[model samples]
Target: MSILVRGMHGLGDNLHQRAVIRQLMARDEVFLESSWVAPYHDLVAAGLKILRKATPLRTQSKNADREASLFHRGPLPPRAQEVRITYTPDLVRARGSVLAAMCWATATDYAAADFRMAVPAEWLQQAKLLFNAWQPRKPVLVYRPLVDRTEWGGCRNRNPDHGAYAALFDAIRDDFFVVSIADLVPGQEWIVSRQIRADVELHKGELDFETLAGLFKLSAGVFASPGFAVILAQAVGTPVACVFGGYENSSSFAGGARFSPTLGIDPINPCQCFSHSHACQKSIDIPAASARLRAFFAEAARHWPGCA
Candidate 1:
């Protein structure tokens, strides 16, 4: 019997869910049915077929029953089984294993293996062309600056201040070609560095998932806020240095400890207003964070001979 997996909402959530789906694919014929298919088309091309004929559903609904019903929509072929899996901070904390929690929810057996993401060969070629066009002189470090708005699940408070990001960019530009991958909103351009430097480049426009995966694969390391990019970098075997405001615990996420050696701020005493509002009173030591990040890169450089 073939299995159908319900999709999660955000890019990061969907990426994390792949750990479970990959295992299911190993045991049974599996297909993903979700409205969020565009971000993961690279996987589809790599052999994970998606149910495109299924009716698209909104990410959330007012009625809880309706929300669950979306997964049941569209016709399934004979002998197709549906599986539902949910990953949350509570589940991660309780299970002490992100992969296990994802597998437990879907009733799949977990295997100890590295998380895998498919970067299409074409996309890798495109990334090579793009990087060559930029003519970077030093090792490139990719980054994503958090937007100032609070649209995606009250995450605005987790975004570092523009000044703090500016300090970080300034600190690292001498040794690494720093690139910001965030698609900034109009009038919100100041969230990243404005200084004219040869080593700094702001990637304008929206980049598709394949291109992003390719970029991550080519980078020396990634420095990003808590978001999809961090997970993407990890999936491509690139080390990450995460910058957080005060909301998330560093250990709560799957790759936070394994891939990220340094965090921008301490998560031990999180601000009371975390994950709810943007009025955070916690202070981030930008200079110290920058030094730690440099140290991380130095360690990574030893393994990546070209980066040295």
Candidate 2:
């Protein structure tokens, strides 16, 4: 029997899933499936031997420890040993206990896959579609707007602040649209209201990886976050002016970005990100970030020979 491991959560979780699958597949024929996992359904579809657990009539199940097993009753392409591992300590050695062994077994260990770095082929295709659908004459501007849980001193979250980096587009609003992936509330949509000068796209569920890739292909430059999208954008062959959020994960994640004022890198007074309350999100200085971003764009234009 082949194995089907679940728990494909956010970028980090997906990495765990992939890592575990890689380990299992090395020994026996294992199939990695993540349909029961939200946000990663498309990814699972793009891969082979992955059966969806969504359609009850479409899945296939066998008599196994029902509690320990997670099976798809759908069209079973070819059955593999099935198991489920979450983003729990038991799976990844969270506590540094002999735990990783106690839980997964110490006999022969399989290193987990680094999900953030693993871009599914489907997402690349999605990016291609986005570029093709939105045909623009002017160079594109791709951005990742910061979303904070709360506001604090100099921690502006509105359009004026977020668009501080807008100077990169050469004042061509029709040519560029910034992308925001932060889950925005109806009331919070206006945070980036000022980007009206430039076409700004807030990518909720509507825009997938293909759309993002398309945008990257069409862009003159990117204003990236310290997040997953930024990593993807850079990898898609786009010149990016990125800014880190608050920690080492901020810099190391997207191949490194200029740290934001909210990250103690800003020259502004009292450095909002330096506060003890973890106000970095709120303290990100829009103007400071924007200035650096604009410079990066200009440099890209001057040097990014094929990218323009």
Candidate 3:
């Protein structure tokens, strides 16, 4: 029987997860690598065989007293009974699809493989086909200044909070089409600035793969905040205004774009958390950000054309 398992953890990331499924599907009778987890439903439907592994649940507590009562767990079902699994709390199990994903085989793996399934040639567009097809064809632009925060590590919510960011965005919105997929979406009443009361909606998609890449190519430009999206955009030859932080770019995969990384080391645990996303929250100014954005889009216009 083919064995499917997850050696990584945290519901996994986008790239790590997709590569696993893609690699496993190529096998014959061997179908999936469920990795002995419960979240294999959606991924299995996409392909890959979800197998069952018969392994007893380990005790979460190391205390002797608690360890004694760890036997309360029961065995998995028959489909699960046919296999054995290894404990991989970190989730980095792309034995074969690693090169395609373009990261080090030694890089920590994740089950949430968003990028692997999000970009690439066919994958990116196909992933968004269902969603983008429905967006009102009103010349939508992905306005993400979050990259500035990631660049310098200076907490400049300037767009709305840091300074005049909210006003700047409002000004731009009045004359141009805009939408936001910010890292943290405050409450509708939170009012980034004066609560212009703008709304951004999400639509579900059902694209195959190749189509996904096409959409990325069509984008005017990507205003990002040092995240995987920027990397993916660059892969498709789309220009990226990376609002990033820290000179040490751990997530810098294959790409060629300007790194508008933020400032500040915040030395004593700058992010308060090591994750890259948090670093960007500190930098990024509004007026300065707006000027850069206009330039980036204008540059994109030279290639995509027909924009103000």
Candidate 4:
């Protein structure tokens, strides 16, 4: 049987689908989206076909938008069975992880799935060279700027006070070599400037996708808002100290959806506010968060030899 797995909504969603895709590749021929091809260099080399679709024009009309969506999503072979993956909170809680939830969606065995990302040998080598150049004397800690979703109904519920991150980074400065990572839009460096100053900056173009995943594998851990960075770290077997705000806890993304049980980090929201509204105005406790992150990294270092 031939399978056409539709592309997911975001980078993290696409990463979660990797295990499911691998399961399909073992049983049948599989085709994936062009946008989804970059992160899975290994899978592509292993025989995953890139789905080709006609490009659509940019337009504001509803009918034109619908047509564009169809153009990118359709023209499937009549004999090929298409699989559309969907997400729900209930399914995620039941399966214990988003990867498991997706596995269940595609009739794949959840226990047998492997979520670790495999990059090319060259990428790993390049990452090691980059790490050595830094001469990092302490355990490396990744610091990503706080960025909220900008499209498809933006959610600010998980956004904490930008100043909180600065304090956290400052507390860990002497013990950790911080590497700030973000792809800021032109004239938008304030997104990171407000977060914290780091020993090194890896903005856009500093490294490619696979190489960055390789760097994550070598790091002690990462501090990020709930998003793709957390998923990327988990995929590469790196510990992540997810800095969550009051509106939403790790249950939605970090701890619940994409939690790696072996990592041993409970990225829960520790704030006084729990309003479901997107405009939630609760402040996160940075001092407490910093303490937990320090402890989390200490534990990770005990097990992960890469921390040295």
Candidate 5:
């Protein structure tokens, strides 16, 4: 019998959960139920079945603990083996991959397989067509800035100021066609400075999740704050440079540490704040983050000479 599972709400979280799902599938048939499963179509292609359901919109509340608990305790289907994965302080303190943490929490054995996803041949063709249509003069580097609303649990402190990123764009625009996929709400369009925006090819609308994944697969590299794009890029084996705002605590939580040892820049200092807090007192050093991205691009260029 197949074990039914509920997936995480965010793309990155869900991607991390794939590792756990793979481990489960090895022992029993796995059926994943999630409203936000478009990003995991690749997983479906790889043999996992999904039951689509719409996720409820999250709202800000004074009771942070209650809100957090609600997300951690996702819906459990009757008759299916339920894996109770909670994002507790203890789990965060473990400083391991969320997949491993989940396994440990449930007393299940951890599988050491590298994270993997399947991109359909058709998706590759689509990406190629899209790339050619854009006619970029240089190799493409996708950048996803932290542009979600303040109420959305994206820590404001982690978001780089416009000037810092614009400087980074100026530093690299001569060598690569930079693409910005920051999700901008109306009236907040200027958050990305004019200097950076001028240099970047803006992907304005919300991208179909599959298309975003396809673009990540085809890019020379990716640069972004820790979010869906960063995780997706890493999953597809694309080199990634990530800027961690004061939210990541890889030393404590497995999810926080999952991106470590990958081709990316982690926060220079340990972040003591909660991952979703709006009250984080610490912020990333923009100039230093920019430098790390520059180095990442340089290394990627060496390995992928075609992009140089």
Candidate 6:
């Protein structure tokens, strides 16, 4: 049997779907989008087939049935099926993590879904080269200044106050070498300008996925809105100080789709505000957020001893 699993939407969405995709690959021949293959280097090396020129799908805030139908050129072959992780309002209401939702959608064991990936040695070598060139005395903390915005998708409501982020970075600058990174490519004007203050601006959008993953492994932590950076940091075993806001709850992205009382650095939605607009993001308390970040890094230092 063969299954063509559509990993549509952003890098983050595809990443969340990786574990489920891995399960499917074990049971049947699996096909995935070509563009999405970069983050799946291990899976590709393990033999996941690539499908080129396929229409990528986004199920969030859209009709799932219609979106799933887009994957079909004709009727699927006998004993085969197409799969996509669909977002429902109820999923948010129930506070389900994307990984669990994907598992349910695919009939895969939720307990088996792991977000971690194997970083290639070459990628780490490149990151080491960049790190040595910087010559920083302090530990590295990568900052993601922008939430992803592509020609077809984005969510401004998730963006926290930039000024607050700047203040927080300044507060911690003495102890950490803050390096801000952005995904801005040749023509992504919709992503807006990178505006965060940091010791170095690696925001030229030069870092590729593998290199970025490797960098995350080398860094002390990541500071960003709840997005791919948070996921990647977790995958690489690096701590993250997530500046969460907007309509979503912190649990939607954190430990097992719920707040982990044990994890000190859960996403900080200080204001506890929720709305469809950017006002919720704007409501975050800068001082509280900064305090949380500082505490989080202090805890990270205890774990790494030499890094944070």
* Candidate that scores best on lDDT: 4
For each candidate, give its TM-score against the true structure. Answer: 0.76, 0.50, 0.42, 0.77, 0.77, 0.79
* lDDT over C-alpha atoms for residue 238 of model 3: 64
Model 2 TM-score, 2 decimals = 0.50
Compared with the true structure, the alpha-carbon lDDT of candidate 5 equals: 0.58
Question: lDDT scores for all predictions?
Answer: 0.61, 0.41, 0.36, 0.64, 0.58, 0.63
* Candidate 4 C-alpha lDDT tens digits along 1-308: 87888756566777777878888899888877634455666787777776633233111122223333322343555688887766565676676556667877878887777656865677778778878889987788778877543443333555655666566656666677888887644543325327466899876636656678778888877777766778888787777766565544565443323334222222333432334465544455666767776777777666666633
For model 3, state the Cα shift of residue 226 in Å. 3.9
Model 5, runs deviating above 4 Å: 42-47, 58-78, 106-113, 160-170, 187-195, 198-200, 249-268, 275-291, 305-308
RMSD (Å) of each candidate, 1 decimal? 6.0, 9.6, 11.7, 6.0, 6.6, 6.3
Residues forming the 10-long window of minimal summed lDDT in candidate 2 = 58-67
Ten-residue stretch with the least lDDT total in model 6 = 257-266
Rank the candidate models, highest lDDT first: 4, 6, 1, 5, 2, 3
Candidate 5 worst ten-residue window by lDDT? 59-68
Backbone-clash count (model 2): 28
Q: By TM-score, who's the top model here?
A: 6
Residue 124 of model 1, lDDT score: 80
Candidate number that wins on lDDT, 4 or 5:
4
